[model samples]
Target: MTERHHILSDNAAALSDDAYDSDGFLIEEDGDDTSRPRLYDGDQLEREERAALRRVAGLSTELEDVTEVEYRQLRLERVVLASVWSEGTLEDAENSLRELAALAETAGALVLEGVVQRRQKPDTATYLGKGKAEELRDIVIAEGADTVICDTELAPSQRRALEDVVKVKVIDRTALILDIFAQHAKSREGKAQVELAQLQYLLPRLRGWGESMSRQAGGQAAGGQGMGSRGPGETKIELDRRRINSRIAKLRRDISGMKTHRETKRGSRRANAIPSVAIAGYTNAGKSSLLNRLTGAGVLVQNQLFATLDPTVRRSETPEGREFTLADTVGFVRQLPHQLVEAFRSTLEEVADSDLLLHVVDGSHPDPEGQISAVRAVLADVDAADVKEVIVVNKADIADPEVLDRIRRHEKHSIAVSARTGEGIEELRQLIAEELPQPDIDVDVLVPYDRGDLVSRLHEEGEVLASEHVGNGTRVTAKVNADLAAELAAYRA
Candidate 1:
């Protein structure tokens, strides 16, 4: 763990060296031109020559074994990243590639190198142009890389073609995100949802067996098969597909059951009229830390993408002592896979049903506006556009003041907070109290001394504006929900 942290810190430092300019493009470093091709020669090189070139480029040829297998053994993957820029500034392209590298690291991969090609659009067949694809093949062979990850989701043909040319596993951004979710999911429902998404993704990309799986079967007289084997044998691909389909069906049923249970829980919360405030934001935007800061729930806080996949609900009180539930939900990201969104709908419904959304943003990130836009896109997809939102710029301790000021100017109700240092937390709490739904009824009641629980409930669930002791009991003037008002009706003053 310490070693991983050190590696992550080092990577962060490397990423920070390049600064974004006014136009959001990285100012090319002194004595370095990004326009110059990393590979100069137009001719294909021999094996040794390609290896030498890779050595010069500092490429590594190590395959990170995937650790998400049933055995749960820890493994590290070494990967090379490639992206084709169809329409974006060089800096925008670089940022996208860097994000992919971060995702790869979160999935326990050591990033070897990242390469981008300027093009009008990704090649429909190979993602990169033919010449660039060939160049990539040589780079893969020289670097000893076993996998190449593209920055965008690839079509089935594109994936196959890239794999064929590079002679390595080829995956896209969506697959990488899904793998990270698979690693972090802890709860039964989380696990089920991730598995369902994986199956859905796999179902479409499942490869068919070639000639080896197409051999014809013979009858018993030919001594090649029995009565049941008079025709073509079941291809391995077919059997695998059938098994996957069965598992997918089972997962859907299981997820449905989980959804029902979740709805029941939500229904119970509603019946009690406890207002729910859901914390949501881009992945690694300090949401878990914020939740911990607010409620002291002590959730797992990691500086990695999609670190917390399971939802955690913790009880909290506003400054007025009005109790509510704060739910830490799964974070969103740019281009979050559709399969994951559909599969985790039940969990996301928690966000959709919330009385308020505390949309946290990493004010320190280079592209805070982009993060906000991406999160909003996902929220719209889940039909949560109508839900009330309170934009929160967290990590104020380390954020750029200019960025914070800009965000605050644009978002009137936004607050700058540092969950780590406790800066602006009290103000944030007060703001939450002010924004939350207030009690609808004001009541004056005299409770019997024996019914002290009602008074306690009043303090915990309502805003007790005033209180006094009377001979019969306690006289309280408070604003509360309908249920509490009904309970206090018997002792109405």
Candidate 2:
């Protein structure tokens, strides 16, 4: 009890007071009160729209009796966070729990209390040891919490055991994250990917009990006196599993079609030789803010974790007039579920196929390095590790100077910038331009007036160094990829 009290006090003190503004959003640093443009207003409108759809407390209760298997939806209201500190220092354990608390809050849970148990390893059956589970039950009861969210992904058996001990719904880190994705997914492809991930996570954890779950026919055919029940059948649980498997297969097919569409679009970009830059970072690390700043993307910029699940691609131009596509991707997190990674593989392909990656890090976070490592782990999983990367340490205005210095000193090709105040943004832009793949062939060409479209292509797919309208045609000097240069070979000046 004393240790629990200590843990609570430490975590309470560690919580950020200034992370949110009065409206419960990441403090908007854009600084204008009355002069916001239409795009900025659209960003605000998007956030308000999400706010309107937030889950209401007490509305998510499941049936009292476990008659059949149900999707393990997060009952997020009034949750007590629990963790097993099997390894890492007390500080590390505390940090992990604190992160879990944030995750719960983002999922619209009111965190009532957080507790950690010291163990060499998590208990196989209950996650927390049996006695510790009882202690957790006491904490849940004392706090009147409706749910317990474990800090790790629990096995199905472990979740059931913990629920039996605590007498409340128990969810794990994976489910909590999945819930966030479910809430934030907007695009058709995004929704399908999230559903696939949820089903994958739900399949093994499905549970049922008693005669209600038995769908096998028991009638005259089975030497029983019944007429309505005589039929070929499987157990209810098996039927449910079959249905889920069917849905999974359908989702895969639908996603495959969407992937083809996406690939076609990507192929068009490739055909034009336009470079791509992907913004990749930890959840709520200001990736969207950076995108809005860089490209005027007008994406919803909420402070919550996984606030933006759909990848947004916007056309942007370098300071030197080279055009490219900048994509804001779904943010990464510590222990991002493998199910999501597998489901979102097509989406993540944007990162893998990009010419450059702007690896954004929240410079203000306590463990910026950890965030970087987690993001890189996901990137590696998607085979995006070899992409040229520029570490953009964002939120420089509020970041600790020491932390900023540490990150800059440690990571090569890193630049510290505040996406809000525009501090160091030009430097970041210059860095990005330098890191982006440059066109190899330089061409000076003169084309007839009828070939104006070629001049347009020269400006779009290549870096136009000089251009002029001649009496007979358009004269252009540019650096371009080999494919574009070959097209202009006939008109070489």
Candidate number of the best lDDT: 2
For model 2, how does the per-residue alpha-carbon lDDT over 379-402 read when each residue is reduced to its tens digit? Answer: 999999999999999999999999
**RMSD values, in order shown:** 8.2, 15.0
Show model 2 residue runs off by greater than 4 Å. 1-4, 7-76, 220-225, 228-232, 464-477
Please provide TM-scores, in order, for all candidate models, with all chains considered together. Answer: 0.83, 0.82
lDDT of 1 by residue, 216-252 (tens): 5677654556777777667667877889999999999
TM-score of 2: 0.82
Local lDDT at 35 for model 2: 28
